[model samples]
Target: MENFDEQFSITKTVEFIQKNKSTRVILQLPPKLLQFSSKIEKHLKKALKNDKISFFILAGASTRHCCVDTVSSARVFGDLIVHYGHSCLSSTAQIPILNIFIPTKISIQNIISAFETEFSTQKTKQMILFYSTEVENSISGLYLQLNKTFPNLKRTLLNLPKNEKEKVKKFEQKQEQEQEQEQEQEQEQEQEKEQEQEKEQEKEKAKEEEKEQEKEKEKEKEKEKEKEKENLKIFGRVLPITDITQLSKNQLIWLGSSTNPTLFSLALTFGAENFLVLDPEKEYLEFEKMERMQPMRRILMKRYALIEKAKKSENIGIVVGTTNPKKDLQIVKYLQLLIKNSKKKSQVISMGVVKSLKLGNFVHDLDLFVVIGCNESLILDQSDYYRPVLVPDELDLALNHDREWDGTINLNFYPNHDMIANLEKKLKQSFDLILIEQQNQKQIENLIISRSETRSFKGLETRLGENKVTKIEEGLSGRASQYQDEIDLN
Candidate 1:
C-alpha cells in the first residue's frame, strides 16, 4: 500500500530482485524468439550467481498459455517476472516487473555500412534513424557520439511507442515525397534544354534562307549576261550555211545528224579531220560510209569510256534523223552519254528530215540530216532540178516537241508525215528561219542525259558493258513497249 507502483521503475526493479535471496525469476518470451530468450536467461542467471536466486525457464505449452493472471500468480508465489523479447502489456502483482527488450538477432555489419552510405549521400538537410528498443539501446549511444564528432550532420533517433506501426507509415510517406520532387526537377531541366535546341535550329534555318536568296539573285544576273552575249554573237556572224567553217572556231552549233553527207562535209570544212559517229545502227553506219567520205567511227565500248570521250571532244553535238527515229534516238543517246561524260562542255545538235521526198511508191528520200561537228555542212538534198534547203524553223519545232515530251516515234513502222510537217512549220516560225535545218536537239540532249543518269557499272568487262542497252525485237509484237512503259512510270 505504500507506493507499490514506484518500485516498477527499471532501477528499483533491478534492486528489488537483487535483495531477495530466494527470488524466483520467471522468464516469459514469444515463441518466435525462444532462442534469444534462452541466451538472455543464461546471461542474467550468470550475473546473479547466488544459488538463492531460483530460475524457472517457462517454454512450449507453458509459454503459449501465459497471461497476466498466470504471471501474477508466479509473483504471489514469491517469484519476479522478467519478460524477454516482448513489450510489456499489463502487470497485476505488487512485485516488480522487468521488461528486458533483448534483440532477437544482431544487426549485420553490411546493413550498418549501407545505412552510413545512404545517410552521407542523402540530399535532404535532415534525416532520421529508426530502430526497435533493443537495437536503439545497442547502437543509439554510439551514433549520438559520432554525430557530435561531425557537427554538420544531424540525426533523430526514433524511440517509438509500444505500437510503432503508424510512425513507420509516416516515415515512408515522407521519403516517397522527397524522391518524387527530385524526379520532377530533373524532368523540368531536360524539357528546358530541348526547347533551347529547337530555338537554335530555327535561328540556323533563318540564316540559311537568307544565304539561299542571295545565291539565287547572283545566278539570275549571270544567266542574263550569258543571254546577252549569245544575242550579240548571232548579230555578228554570217548566216548558217551548208558549210560553217566561215564561222569562228570557238563558235558552236548543234548539227542534228551523222547520216548526212552535207553534215560530214561541214565537219571537214571546220578542220574536224576526226569523226566521232555515235551511230549504233548497222544501217546508218553503212550509209555514212557510202554517202559521206570514210570517216573515223567513234563507238562507245563502255558507258564510262563514253563519258571520257565526250568530255575530251572539242566540238560536241547530237545528230538525229527521222528516217529511223528509234535508231536515231539510240545514236542520240550515245552522243548524250558522250556529252554528259564530257561534263558540261559538249553542245548537242539534232538533225532530221523536214519532209519525206517520196520517189514513186517504194522509195522515200530522207531530206533531214543533223551534222554535229565544228561547223555546219553546205551540201543540200537534190530533187531533179530543185535543191531543198534544210530549214532551222523545222528543226526548232521538232526540238520543242522533243524537249516537251518523249518524241519516241517508231519511224520504221509508224512514220506520221503530217505530224512531222507540222513540227517543222512550228520550228520555222519560232526561229524565224525560212529554210531551217530540221533537227531535234533536245532528243539528243535527253539521250546524253539518260545515259548520264545511269549508274556506272562496277567490275564489268569493257566489251560486255557496251551492250548495256536493253534490246527488243524490231516489231510491235515485242515486249519493248511494255518495258518502255515501266521505265516511263518510274
Candidate 2:
C-alpha cells in the first residue's frame, strides 16, 4: 500500500472498527437531525460485519457546530464520537471526532423517497420544497435538478426555517413592544371618545325618561274616564238573572247572585249580552217560564227527551243510573213496562246497581234516569246503548273520583253562627259544597233554581266521601338530607 490512507478509503472505517471487536461507535447529532437516526443506524450496521461491534446514539441541541465539549467527554469515556451533518469541529476537542456530511443530493433523494414510501403514491406531480432562507438557494438548485429528473412534476420554493413559529415569535414580541407604545399614545383619545358617547347616551336616557312620565300621565287621565263610564253603567243596569225568561232567543245569560267577579269579567270579555238571576223558591215550571236553568240540568233534560223519543219511534232506549239497589230495580221494572207498551219498533233497556248483568248488565242506550253518575258508570251499567250522556253535579264528582276508592272523608268545620252567605263565600275558593248553620233566603233560592235546572239527579254520595290515595306515614324521612350525607361521605 502507498500508505494506509492511500490504500483504504475512510468509507471502510466502520469495517476496520468492527474487525477490532469491542469497538463502540457513539453518534452525536443535533436533536432535530436525529430524525434520521433509524436510517443512519441501519446503514452503519450494514457496513460492519463483526458481531461484537456496538453502537450508541447521543443527541443534543449543540450539534450545529459539532459540539466539541461533548465530543471530548465521549472520548474521555472511551467512546468514538461520530458527529453527523457537519464538516468541521472545534480545535479544543482532543478526542478523535469523525465528521460526516450527508451529500445534499443524496439527502434530497432520501427525503423524497421517504415521503413517497410513507404516502404510498408515485405521483409527485406538484411539490413545494421549504428550507431556511440562508440555505434556500442551495435547496432551490437541488429542486431544479429534481425537476429535470422528474419532468412531469412542478415545484414551488419557500423559505421556511427562519419563518418557523419560534423564529416568528421573537419578531412578534418586538412588534408588540412597539404596538404597546402606540396604544399608550391612543389611550387618551379612546377615553375622550368613550366619555363623549356616554354623555350622549345619558342625554338620550333623560329624554326617554321624560317621555315615559308624560305617557304615564296620559294613561292616568284615560283611566279616570273609563272609571266614570263604568260607574254610570252600573247605576243604569239591572241584575242579570231577574227577568231571564223575558230574554230573546240565542241570548247569553249569567246566573247566581254570588257569581265570581273574574268569571263575570271573563264572560263580558268573551261576549255575553245578558245574565239571568235564578230563584230557588220558584218551581221548575215557573223557572221555565223565565227560560233560565242550570247548565247541568239542561243537559239532563235534553237527554231524557231523546231517550223517550227513541223508545216511541225507533224502539230503542237505554236507561243508565246509579242508585240504591232497591230503587234501581224498581226503575228497571218501570222501564220494562214502558218498552212493552210501545210499538214493535220500540226497544227498552235498563242497567241497575246489580254490578253483574252478563247479557243485560251494561245498557249503553238510554231514555232517562233519576240519578245517573258518569260516562264510565253508564258504560259499565249499559254497554249496549249509544245515547247522549247526562250526569249529576255536571260530572264533577264522576271526573274527580279516584280510580280506586279509598275510605278517607272530609269534614267541614265552621266557626259558630256562620251564615250561608259567608260560608259559601269562604268555601267558594276551596270546596264545592256550602256548609252553614242556616242557609240564606237568596242562597236557598239560588240552590233551588240550580236543582230545578237539573234534568238528572246526580250528587256526591256523602256516605262514601273523600278518600286518600297515598299514605303519608309511608314516605321516607329527610330523604333529601340523607342524599346529601351520602354525597359528603363519598
Candidate 3:
C-alpha cells in the first residue's frame, strides 16, 4: 500500500540523493503514487543511514507537469524535490528536481511481435510513430526497428495549425482581391480609342495577359495555402498541435503513452480517426482510435460563448495570480492595452490563490474577471461562483480581432514572446469534461450534474453568440413564472 509495485532505477535515485547529500528533500508524486511516498522516504533514509537528513513527501494535489510543485516545495523550505509519474518539462524549475516517471520495462522483440500481429491488418496508407518522452526508451527500439523493417513509416511530431483571426483576415483579403478583379475587368471592357480595329487587337492581347496573370496568381495562392496547411508551431513538449495536411487523411498515426489528459484533448482536436494509441504498458500491443471528440466541440462552444460575454462586459477585473511578476508584467500591460482598445473600465486584482469566496468580494465592482496564470492554468469551478472567470487567451478571443482562439481551450497564460502576437494554445482537456467526470463520480448518490449547469448564458443572447448548438437549461429559460425548476441547484 505504501510502495509502488512498478520498477524504476532505485540505484540512480540513491546516487542522486548521495551526490546531493540533501538534508531536507521533498518527494512530489501524483495521487496513485502518493501512498508509496512513505515507503520511498524510509528507504532513502535507511540507504543513507543519515538520521539528520530528512525526506518529506508533498501532500498537495498534483496532476501534471503544468501544475508543478516547485512553489509548494519552496514554501516548505525543501532543499530538493523528486517528482514522479510524468515526463519532465524542458522549462527549468525554481529548485532542483529529479523526475522519476513510472517506468514500464518490456522487451523490444516481444513488443514488435505484438505490433506485427495487432497492427498489420490496419489499412492506413502511411504510418508515423510518436513516443511520450517518459517511456521513449521503452518504445525507442521499436521505432528504429519499424524504420528499418517497414522503411515506409515516417517519424514526426504534431504541429498546431492557424487560429481564427488568421482565417478571417485571409477571407477579407480574398474578398478585396475579388472586388479588384471585377474593377479591372470593368476597366478592360471600356474603349477610349477611336481606332476600333487596332483597339480590338490591343484589348485581346491585354485580356490574354490578364488571364495568364490571374492563373499565375491563383497558382501562387494555392501554393501559399498548401504551405500554411503544413506548417504549425506548438509550445513546449506536452500537446503541440499539427497541421492536418502534413498528417495523412488516410493514415494511422500511433502515439506512445505517457499519454495523459493533454494528449486526450489533442487527439480529439486533431481528429480521432486519424490517430491511434500504442500503449506498451498493456500486455498486448493494441492500437485503438479515440471515438469521442464531441467534448472538445462542447468546450469550444462554451469558450466562444464566454468570448461574446466578455466583448459586452463594461466592468472588467484582471486577476493576477502568477508566482513570477517580472515575466508577467508584459502580460499585464498587454491586458491593459486590450482593455483600452475595447474601451472598457478595468481594475487589477490579486489574491494569492483564487477561490469563490475571494472573488465574490468584488461581485459588485466587476461584471467579468480575467485571470492571469503564467505556468499553471487557473480554472475556477463556477459551481458556486456566478461571475465568469476567464484567462488571457479567452480575452483575446473577445476583444482582439487579430488574435483568435484556436480551440486550444487551455487556461494557462504563460506569455511566450512568440505566442504574444498569436495566442494559439489549447486545453489539456475541456474543463467541462473534467467537471462532467467529477459529477459522474458522485453518481452513487444518484445525483448527476451536467457541465452546462455551471455557466449562465445571459450574456450569450447576442448575435455574435448565436452559433450555439446546445440548448439552455430549462430552469434558466423562464419556463415557469415562479422558477419552480430550482431544486438544489449546484
On TM-score, the candidate that comes out on top is 3
Q: Write the per-residue lDDT of candidate 1 for residues 8-98, one digit (tens) a residue.
A: 2234334546643336776666676566555555555555666677666556422112222243334347455665543322223444445
Per-candidate count of clashing residue pairs (backbone under 3 Å): 34, 27, 10
- TM agreement with the true structure for every prediction: 0.23, 0.19, 0.56
Candidate lDDT scores, in order, read: 0.39, 0.38, 0.61
TM-score of 2: 0.19
Can you write out model 2's per-residue Cα lDDT over 201-222, one digit (the tens) per residue? Answer: 7568867986996798689779
**Runs with alpha carbons beyond 4 Å of true place in candidate 2:** 1-22, 61-65, 69-76, 106-490
lDDT of 3 by residue, 1-490 (tens): 2234235445556666655555788788777777877777767766678878777777763333434465677766886677676542423455555667666566677656766766577524356555554554455566778666565566544221122223344455667778966865665578445456765676798789879977986997899787656545232232222544555543544455524554553453455555666666677666566544235456556767888999999989988765556745778877876676566888998654667788899999899989875333445246777689888878877887777666555444445566444322212234457788988777844533454566576354557865758877544544564455567455
- Arranged by TM-score with the best first, the candidates are 3, 1, 2
Q: Ten residues in a row with the worst lDDT in model 1? A: 405-414
Per-prediction CA RMSD (Å): 47.5, 44.3, 27.2
Give me the overall lDDT of model 3: 0.61
